[model samples]
Target chain A: LAKTTQPISMDSYEGQEVNITCSHNNIATNDYITWYQQFPSQGPRFIIQGYKTKVTNEVASLFIPADRKSSTLSLPRVSLSDTAVYYCLVQGSARQLTFGSGTQLTVLP
Target chain B: EPEVTQTPSHQVTQMGQEVILRCVPISNHLYFYWYRQILGQKVEFLVSFYNNEISEKSEIFDDQFSVERPDGSNFTLKIRSTKLEDSAMYFCASSERADTDTQYFGPGTRLTVL
Candidate 1:
């Protein structure tokens, strides 16, 4: 398991793009970067995952640099409902996934 | 989307009492996991099950904790003795595979141990 560091909190307004970056300096070769979003009183939900380069889905985009030491989760045109805690996890096979304190994203109206 | 479902949205129990939390994972998923979040804390992994056996478990999963897949559709977690520290939101999740598949999580069972 690779330890991850992200901001403690972020503030965004409606219709603006929000990008949250995670730093995993000790990332291993087999580790993959995965992002999850959790609202209060709910389970975490998978947002995006990537091994390298960039991957995009209906909800968000993940950008992994060439070094793979860090990754960014980008959410476009955010809304108030997007307010949640975002977690960045790095792990390989046969390892228990760990979640850090995560970045608390507050989407203001 | 097929999602995991957990029973007893909220459970209140006394100290030293045994409690069982049940979950119904996605129909096609093969890997199951249990995680808990102490209020205002990070989510912690408890255990992962695959092929009718435990693949991984955290230190938090002590002797008091056990997991079982009684039948094809249901997965369960048992706490032999509850403590006040056991109060937290227990989440059940499942993935199609363990390597890179995305895990879908249930709403969670909020256990309050007094």
Candidate 2:
């Protein structure tokens, strides 16, 4: 599995855009970048996923650079309810997901 | 949005006692997984089940831990002997497919072992 590194914490005010970047220096060719969000006392919720370039959905947008060494999760117009831990996972052929210390995003009012 | 559901939102058990945590995955999903998170810690994968059998498991899934799809709808995790370290939030998730499919997770079962 490819190890991922992301910010430990980030603060954003309501209505501001939030971009959380994750670096996977040793990412494999077959790996895909996926993101999940988790509030306290709840299971992690899938946000978005991408293999390369950019992918956008109703929830968020994923921006993968040409090198694929890193990816960014962009959330537009953040709200107080968006406060949670954001996890950036590099998914490989392995069935199990290896989670790292996620970035805690604090959306202030 | 069909989501996974887990029973017994909270469970309190004594040390050495057996506990069974149950889950009902999305109706059409094929892959199932179990993950746990200690308070204030990162989520850790325990095991993944597909086609009524286990596909992979982490070191944390020791002999004391077992998973079963007893029936078509219910997936269960059994802890033969609970320890204090077993106290955590157990989450059950399922994906429609293996590769690139998004996994939907349940609210989780908080197991407190004393």
**DockQ of the candidate models in sequence:** 0.71, 0.81
lDDT of 1 at B38: 98
Q: How displaced is residue B59 in candidate 1, in Å?
A: 0.9
What's the lDDT for residue A6 in model 2?
100
Estimate, for each residue in A15-85, the C-alpha lDDT of model 1 and write its tens digit: 99999999999998888899999999999999989999999999999999999999999999999999999
lDDT by residue for model 2 (A56-106), tens: 999899999999999999999999999999999999888788889999999
Best by lDDT: 2
In terms of TM-score, the best-performing candidate is 2
- For residues B33-107, write the lDDT of model 2, one tens digit per residue: 999999999899999999989999999999999999999999999999999999999999999898667889999
Local accuracy of candidate 1 as per-residue lDDT tens digits, B1-114: 788999989999999999999999999999999999999998999999999999999999999999999999999999999999999999999998886678889999999998
Backbone clashes for every candidate come to: 0, 0
Candidate 2: TM-score of chain A is 0.99
Per model, the share of native interface contacts recovered reads 0.66, 0.74
